[model samples]
Target: MSPEEAPARRRGRPTGSRAGAPETREAILAAARSEFAARGYAKASIRGIARTAGVDPALVHHHFGTKEKLFGAALEFTFAPALVVPEILEGGPEGVGERLARRFLSTWEVPEVRERLIAVMRSALTEDAAAAMLREFVSRELLLRIAAQLDVPEPHLRAELAASHMVGMAVLRYVLQVEPLASADPEELVGLVAPALQRYLTER
Candidate 1:
């Protein structure tokens, strides 16, 4: 076929281009963050993210392997609420505790994310780079966003309490794999845990 008649080459993923070119990868990651922030993990689409990045969807797929992997990458970089809780605060203050608890627990169950979370937690405890990342995210993205959503007076304090409680549950259930806690039905755990979080966030 003539050059004019040949198929148009995709941008970012050039013909014979190497995988993970710095500019392309950074572009994709930035677009991924924007997409995740706007749509949350479950609703964010690879096609949409690729478009946002000015790349092909196949490039994104080849780069990350799966949505779970991409989400994990996003979290490892910044630990934003979009990937962490998806849209936990979207439904408003009603049942937010259940939303937060359910989302947090379920997100930790994803294998790709679980691995990164382990790394993050360990590094955080040891005061590494991940520690700074987590601290910034929790203080800015997680806590303040959550605090802003609630009707409570000490919203920041309430948000902090809820985050601590949730993280403690994760340590026992996921990191340590404590029996009963680890083995318990998720709904049952959510039932047990959501009320306290709700009280922390909403109770005046």
Candidate 2:
């Protein structure tokens, strides 16, 4: 065969990483995180991640099985609402704001998750790189997912605004302990905050 006629080299691993190899698994996870961080959960794909990791796509499926599971592994953030947010959505959109607010508040109240969140938040606050990754993960994975569910104009803006309110509330009430808000009952706070959130969520 002529040199110019040689078949193009196939990219990535030929047969995928051997099953149950820790180093290969870690490489796939690292690639998954990078893809997720750059492209967001909704847009990132198994094929793309595999390409980035220099592995066959089958390897990714072998390691993580599903996109949701892969995202969970890549993130390793127990405090993220991505898991339970859909359950909260199942009650319908009429009371999404109230449900979302209550859910967000309740999530922060978990003892183990709270401790881990504090550590992540502290790292983000202190490190520029960590903060950027955290910001992207929140915007793409969490906020965008919630926003896309709403049948509203400017879904991205709406999601961001609603999330801003919730994050601000969390920081003030839970982190900074700003009085009144800090001391207020969860139900009372939900009542006070839900209307604005509802407006952002449902209104045009």
On TM-score, the candidate that comes out on top is 1
What is candidate 2's lDDT per residue for 1-204, written digit by digit as tens?
A: 567434432333454325457877887877776665556556678999988887778888988898767765655644445557656766778998899888887887776555545555555576565566667777767766776677889987887898789878877877798998888988898898999988988887
Residue 126 of model 2, lDDT score: 62
Clashes per candidate, residues 3 or more apart or on different chains? 0, 0
Ten residues in sequence with the least summed lDDT for candidate 1: 9-18
Which ten residues in a row are the worst by lDDT in model 2?
4-13
Model 2 misses residue 38 by how many Å? 28
lDDT of each: 0.73, 0.72
- List ranges where model 1 is wrong by over 4 Å: 1-16, 19-78, 81-86
lDDT by residue (1-204, candidate 1, tens digit) is 568434444343442253457887778877877776556555678999988988778888888888667755766574543344425666777898898888887877787566556655765575444355567767777677666677889888988898889889889988899998988988898999999988997789
